[model samples]
Target: MTECDINNQTISRPGNSWLAAAVWNNSYTYKVSAHCPLHYCLPYSTHLNFSIPNSQCQFKRAGILCGHCQQGLSTIFGSSNCQKCLNIYLFLIVPIAISGIILVLLLFILNLTVTDGTINAFILYVNIISINTPVFFPQLGKFTPAYTFISLVNLDLCIQTCVYNRDDYAKMWLQLAFPFNLIFIATSLIITSRYSTTIQRLTARRALPVLATLFLLSYTKILLIVSSVLFFYSKIFHLPGDHTELVWSVDANVPLFGVKFITLLIACFIIFLILVPFNIILLFTRWLSRFTLINKFKPLIDAYQGPYKDKMYYWVGLQLVLRVVLFAVSSLDRNNNVIIGIVLFILVIGLHGTTLRPFKNEIKNYQEKIFIMNILILFALALYNHGTTNMTAVNVMIGLAMGHFILIVIYHIFTYALSGVTRNKLQLHINTLVGWIIRLLNKNPVHQSRLDSHVMNKIPTAVNYHEYREPLVVQD
Candidate 1:
């Protein structure tokens, strides 16, 4: 053991593994030790000399040990192997850590419809719309396939930029996310198909449950669309890397059979596979209507008639096409071109929605129009701020977009709150309050007396009652 003395306090170095200090304050002494083992490093080093031992290390109280402390410990122990072992451990650990997180999230999303059947259609639609928005705006020049994948979870895996390469990490995430999203999409489709009859029955009995299931199915479909689009985009616009080595690239065709192949498959699946049941029902009902044997089941066929009649599958397919177009335009790597493409797409969809009104609910049709208008204005601002160097204008546009998003969210929430009995009751209360106020205001003594006098002045004094009475008696 070695001893050092400072401020009448004794500091002791016990063995090669630990440094201990006795601190004196208010006639009390407390011992604090830095257990700097040869294999493990403590972030903070204890100053052995001071009465109150101060920490001399720069690292904050984050869980991981700092490099300086590790190097210091390794130097004191005369061993260079500690850093190598730590690096190997971290190399093995990071992927496992991120994979665990992804698995948890995947499980949660997969179970969302099953565990919670009360999800609101309006809120679900708003979420789908918001999340499906381009994570990287081309005008901002931050467009990267890595960013698109990272934005899915919105997690900051690396706090320090130098710790890990972001592009590589994004590639890892893409590999993990692709498979998980595929599983989610497949499971969701199967579950929805299995419950199709149940949903139809629920439709005739309880509307809310049916709407929730339908919205959930739509959400899964949208998720599939988003995943497929990103996968396709990544294949088309590759980063400066060996494409043959990357798992998500078209050249690295292994599990996906190729990114382009999978994308085409998904597109066809979205356009046709999901519509198979509806087509079957339509064809079956048409064939049955010809034979009088199934005339009694006409009512049953009518229950599933709305979607086919509205040609809503075509509308959905159009949506997927438009999304693909938007992403393709964004890949052109030109800000103004992207903005113009967005504007044109919005115009086309706005026109289509306005004229066709795919939704059965009139409110939803109007809501879609309002949402399109807001998005159009936001993109217009982006276009105006395209070539400008003014930070203020850019910030203002971003703020305006955020404000519009908030307003749309609030509108959806307000609409959801004012539905069914709630809206009716609120209306009744408002009408009652207004009627009460009017009656109270009309109860003014001066006004009432004035009205009575005005009526008195307009009345005849006498004589007319006799002629009126005679006519009434002779009418028989």
Candidate 2:
């Protein structure tokens, strides 16, 4: 896989960075081009300026430029402005996630365990020289000297083991990890496709940042996955010694133990690298007021949170969460794993399409009914799961669709009716319940109008004696 020479290279965008485009050898499993020219992109610049890049968007930091001659910006997955990207992420993720789990579920159903696991290892950095090793010296000849031992190693040569009655989870997940990475690769490619090609401008640079960002995002999941498999391997196959029991098999014939050791070491380093910043952010958020957390996550739910964008974003997130729960349950050694997995699979599929239902039929009343149904669905799931009542999967699916519908509709009610400041406080405080009851029992809030009272009028005249004046005898 060599990069094409300058002679083989052609201009991509009219005025964009040339480095954005790169051609790999035929051996590469996947490829992605860029599509530029989206209006109002969150470029790594002040006010979408193309010259200077900022650290705000992860894509721009990775050198993914605009498809158009324009460059220096990227809309990230969780960015409030990039809800579409989030939707795409979830859309791709749903199936990919389900695929691996489905394979595991199948294995469970068949009661089969196939053996598969990673080579487990750790580094033993002997700061001091090793004991009893011969060291060559001019003056001190043929002396046993302590020397540091730093070596990459292969602990074992055999690769067999995906089969296990109880260990299938680890085995199946291990098998799927690398292949599952292809899903991430595909996701990155889709994001690349978002950078549409223009007649004059090249957008290939956008792929750089998109790929980088995705790789980082995928890191934690991958690390955890690989580490889990490695740990599983160590437990299953290892040198039966007190000190080296957790490491790969120490047999001399086992090939490339060094490579495996370094690989594991690098993996551990990657995990460490990934966790540092996240922990920083977590600590910072904790240090900040409670409102910071809300303000932070507000963007992902921003546009669709209103009546504006597609409700599918919210639905996708919720559906993914539910799918996770279902998978968790399915992983348990229970007969109901099949039934629950199937039911949740249907829900995951159904909820996605549920948003496509005619909006006209989803009037306010219908929406309210959806909210009520969501409340019912919760109870129904609990009851059905516990065997309190017998309900078919279809019935559960219908209930899920209705409940899913409620996600979009309930937000409107929450924002409008319940969110803002309200005058729920009493203007007039009543001391006792009896007083309020007696007060309400009266026909009128007040017994009578204050204006109905009798009234008297008087006029005063001023004179010398008492500031009163006398009238003349004009009538006589």
Indicate which candidate wins on lDDT.
1
Please give, for residues 296-372, the per-residue lDDT of candidate 1 as tens digits.
Answer: 64543443343323454244434434444554454344345446556675765667576677566565556555555
lDDT of 2 at 63: 32
lDDT of 2 by residue, 360-434 (tens): 233532443343344235334543555322334423443454344345335434433442232232323334666
Off by over 4 Å in 1: 1-309, 333-336, 387-476
Worst 10-residue lDDT window for candidate 2 reads 116-125
TM, every model: 0.35, 0.23
Clashing pairs in 1: none
Candidate 1 whole-model C-alpha lDDT, 0 to 1: 0.40
